[model samples]
Target: MATFLRENASELGVRYVIWQGRIWSRGAGDQGGWGRPYDGGGVYDPSDATGGHYDHVHVSVRR
Candidate 1:
């Protein structure tokens, strides 16, 4: 994800902040149909990608 962000940072105006086991947006906020404090956890998959229980990325974009 870091590589992807670096490649499109300028074009997409991407910005981020990391805290409390989650990443937050410095710019984009609750605009992708997702509400603030998006918690990326649901069904637990043992063989899921990221080699973790959840197959999603946690992102919080608001205070």
Candidate 2:
């Protein structure tokens, strides 16, 4: 899913994607990869897994 999203981010107007405690941002360049750890939008709980996005994917789109 991440791979498909990254590949078509431009067409989909995706600004960023968060999953599994990591994030991939379009502005960060592809080389940055999805290795950047997500801060969970500063609303994460200590007991939450994968920055609160462990069970599903979080996608942010450009407006």
The residue-by-residue lDDT of candidate 2 on 1-63, one tens digit each, is 876787799999988887777778886854455647776676885238745577778888888
Candidate 1 C-alpha lDDT tens digits along 4-54? 553465565656532223344545554443223324345433244442313
Stretches of candidate 1 off by over 4 Å are 17-63
- Residue-level lDDT for 5 in candidate 2: 84
Off by over 4 Å in 2: 29-33
TM-score for every candidate vs. truth?
0.25, 0.74
Reference-based lDDT, residue 38, model 2 = 72
Output the lDDT of residue 44, model 1.
Answer: 33
